[model samples]
Target chain A: MISLFLDTSSKKLVVILVKDKEIIGKKELESINDHSSYLVPFIKELLDLNNIKTNDINKIFVVNGPGSFTGTRIGVTVGKVLAFSNNIPVIPVSSLKQYIFSLENYDYYVSIIKDKNNRMYYGIYDKDYNDIVVDKYQTKDVFLKDINDLKNVVFISEEEIDGIDTIKPILNINKLIDYYKDKEINAHYLKPNYLKKIDAEDKL
Target chain B: MNEYKLTTRCEEDTISIAENLEAEKFPGMVICLNGELGSGKTVFTKGFAAALGISETITSPTFNIIKEYLNGEMPLYHMDIYRLEDNPESTGLLDYFDKDGVVIIEWANMIEDYLPEERLDVYFKVIEEDKRIIKFIPHGQKYEELCEDAL
Candidate 1:
């Protein structure tokens, strides 16, 4: 079975094609401004590079986000369209969850994405992969105040925050596919995971 | 909302007012400047950036949309929202406010709905040649104190 993983929730764009337990073709680039333009072409390039056809993709792993509003939409939309058209199982992975997917040794892991002024999408996961602290959009101040009381907490994020030494998350498509294989949703039900409400969405 | 008024007899007076505000500057300070063209809006911004020790020639960000000066005492995110009035994309704009920088938005009234609840607004009114009436309306407690100290 062939698995395709796509993450475009931030400045970094990741496209990985995994065959069985091994990752075959992976492309990670900083396609800063335009995610929509780069996503499909990169998918096609990875498939062509691996000598696989579009119909060979059996499953799709898409990072739905509490991230850049436009970037999140582009990724989720593409994932939905591909899954629907090709009859593949699409799994919606949390961008925050992806930050700590590989850090199971730690008793606790804190994943945060700074979304706006002093506001962030924060989640805490236990060694069992349970969301000990339910994912929510809140001020960094609130998270810091609560974290002061915890022990052996590892912070994972894309940006290096002050005072808190953060571990940069490395996306491993093979590991991610193996872990979230059963968490599949119908493509029609997939939507951008915006933890906070957007101004335009409110108007609609 | 707290409001104050000031009159600048010349461009130097406007510069001094900006300098006084700079004295009270802090990280994440949001200042909104509004006025007609050549109404000393750019003059005030140049004065503020100069006071922040930004030596690079300050040009209006009208064409660039947003100009970032990171070498200053604190980062200065100079933005022109006039062109972005009709644009619906505002994803990364609010992120600058948390960069621990002073965000100065020109033609700020264009996106008043998106502005932070805590900010200072400066309105420039042309009264006569070489003279301008500047009105300061501050929101939130910190901005109210900023006007009390600077205006």
Candidate 2:
């Protein structure tokens, strides 16, 4: 099945077009909050480069939240609208989960995204793919203490720290190809997996 | 889509309305307003002044690009970008955003190039003869909470 993945949760905007387990097209752009302008055009560019059309796409994956509020909304809104219009299944992928999945050979991993409210969007998971989060968001003090108490904890995110071994950012296409290829993963159930509420005027 | 529409109407003049609304704000907020040229942008500033508890008179700093009113509850940075040109390379009048106070920029469309990724984008336009429409959109979680509380 042809699958398309779009992630705009952070500073980097990632777009991947995958045909089953293999990647056919990919595009990346850097902008503060230019998601609305680039989203549809990036999709079109990817499709054109791969000689593929929207009609050939069977599934779309979108990163839901815990990142830029505007970026998350733009990506999800586009994904939802396109999926609904095309009658395709959409897989919601969490930016944090994708970050964790990027690490290689790490048993225990901690993922963090800055919430900018003196707190963090953080969680814990192991190679077994189980969450160890008692809370999705924790204050800086609490998060630091929890990290200090834990052993074999590798931080998987874009942020770098001295005590914690940092993992590079990983795209959802790479994770999907490595982990979900040939696996029985549900498409409709795929969601952003956010621990904290996204702040936006609509939500208010 | 539930089709939710919320309109905040005040019987008082623009200054009083803005002041009442300003009094209900929190830090790290994004405010979007929609009104016409003479529809009370400056009058709204007076309300913001009252909300910030500023004793000074609020005026339109149209030519100055932005003005700071810091002697209040929270720092109030008011801006008027009407004189700004709509060129992406110009960066417009975004230098006002880096301050510590709640930033309010008039004529946002003039500097769309430099708008924060997470901010409140207010659209101000005139509706009827004397009515003004102010549409507020909070881009991030911080602003969302502020909007919720303000509502």
Candidate 3:
């Protein structure tokens, strides 16, 4: 069975195809702000180069972001369209958790996606992949206020933050798919996991 | 105390002033522009971008709200906050100040609260067709120095 991965949450346009939890094809391009135009073409390219037909894919793993407003929505829309049309189950993954799965160090792991106006979308998890605290979206000042002194808390992210130390994430797709394989839901129920509320949330 | 005023008779005069400012461009420079419609805000931006060695046709980012030009000699982040007033929760607006690029905002008065402290604010007053009275207010020492030489 074929499983496709789609993530455009941050600056990158990431697409990976996994067969039986092993990555067979992937495209990870950095600093692609124009995800809407590049996403579909890259998906086709990934499948064509791998000699895998889209019909063969049984399920899809999509990162519904806590990242860029437009970039995340484009990825989510494509994933939803593919799932609903193909009648396949879609797994909605968090953009923050994608960073979390990249590390196994420390008792607690923090995955953060920094946004506009000194704000961030952060997820904190224990080693068991259980939430230590619910995911949040707030200014960096308010979020990092009391957590800076914790020794066991490790910050994991791909992007650099001012004055804050961060370790780069190495995404383990096999572990990711293994964790969310059975958590698939109907395409209609799928939505972008934007932790923060925006003015156009009710409209868009 | 760091304010300067100039009167321009035509579009060329405005373009010259923009190019003069662009000649002294540095990373992380924020230029706040305010004026009524047709007061040469976008025209000034185009001149500045052109002087910065961007070949692309520069246009107002009213619809896009914010547009980034990375192909230029320096990264140029252009924004128009006219329509953004309706949606005040627009995220990441101030983060551009630290991006090591030249950020020019049109209709900048709309987001006066979010404007950085170390920046240049230019207000345009239309005197007549093809004529404008421009006022430059430099906030901080860096911008004060910039205006002393460029304006």
Candidate 4:
């Protein structure tokens, strides 16, 4: 069985391919504003480099948002199209959950993604990767206040957050594939999890 | 007594400032917005709401007086005190200061006497069809640091 995972939830574009539970090829690109233009071609290049045909991919896994709105949409849309065209199963994974999957060793882990301003998208998880606090946006002050009483917490973040024991989390593809082997959803129902409303729609 | 001035070229710029300011938000934080009509006060509020993980559409509270959004990272108590010029006390507006939520008051100048001492005041001035000059006045130490961090 072959599975492909794609994540465009941040400034980085991550693509991973696995065949029969073994790692094959993975690509991570620093794509800031060019996700719409570079995503499909990048995916093709990743597959061609590994000599893996598109038909060989039996399932698709994608990080569906709480990050950059456009970036998340681009990856989700691409995954849905590829899955629907090939009649393959699609799995929508939370970028926050993926961060937790990267930190299974910690007894308590807090995953954070900085949003515009001092606000952040955060989630708290246990060693089993079960979410203790679901993903939400809050100011760094409020987030700290909420976690002030918790003991032995490790913070996983892309950037440095002051006054916290922070570590840069590495997303392990093998662990992720093993963890969510049965959580595939239909391609027709896949949607980006924006977690907030767009500015244009906020008017009276 | 610290003041910060920002010139925004468009609505997006105004919202960007608001979103940035939202990152430093804390419970019982009060933001006082003073601006003329169509001066992007609601735009700033909308940006702040979005940063707080609010999914519902945040409209101006002109008719409602005060609108509460409890689904965000923290509750957001939005107030448009334009109609409260004559009867500010009737609405129990000051009670929100201790609600453990972020409070944003539009046309806040009208209720000057009811405002807390340690609030951040933003005044918007229209420069062009799309341009705005916003001034941030921090009334306390926390707000002053917030201005420094956000600007």
- Across residues B1-151, which tens digit of lDDT does each residue of candidate 1 receive? 6679899999999999999999999988999999999999889989999999999988999988889998889889999887775443444675566557899999998887668878999999999999999999998889999888887
lDDT of each residue in A117-160, candidate 4, tens digit only = 45678888777887788887666777787687777678888888
What candidate 3 gets wrong by more than 4 Å, as runs, is: A146-151, A160-164, A195-204, B1-10, B24-30, B52-79, B83-103, B112-120, B126-133, B137-151
Candidate 2 chain A: worst 10 consecutive residues by lDDT? A195-204
Q: Which candidate would rank higher by lDDT, 1 or 3?
A: 1
Model number 3 iRMSD: 5.6
RMSD of each: 7.4, 14.4, 4.8, 13.0
lDDT by residue for model 3 over B2-107, one digit each (tens)?
6799999999999999999998889889999999999999999999999998998999899988999999889999999987855433465654665668999999
Misplaced by over 4 Å in model 2 are A161-165, A177-204, B1-151
The per-prediction i-RMS, to one decimal, reads 4.9, 11.8, 5.6, 15.7
Query: What local lDDT score does residue A202 receive in model 4, on the 0 to 100 scale?
Result: 22
Better of 2 and 3 by lDDT: 3
Model 1: how far is A142 from its true place, Å?
A: 1.3
DockQ of each: 0.14, 0.04, 0.21, 0.03
lDDT of 1: 0.83
Reproduced native contacts, each prediction: 0.12, 0.00, 0.00, 0.00
For model 3, residues A9-115, the per-residue Cα lDDT tens digits are 77788999998767888888886557788899999998998888777788888998776666678888999999999888999888887766656667788888766
Top-TM-score candidate index: 3
**CA-based DockQ, model 2:** 0.04
Clashes of 2: 14
Return whichever of 1 and 2 wins on DockQ.
Answer: 1
Model 3, chain B: what is the TM-score?
0.95
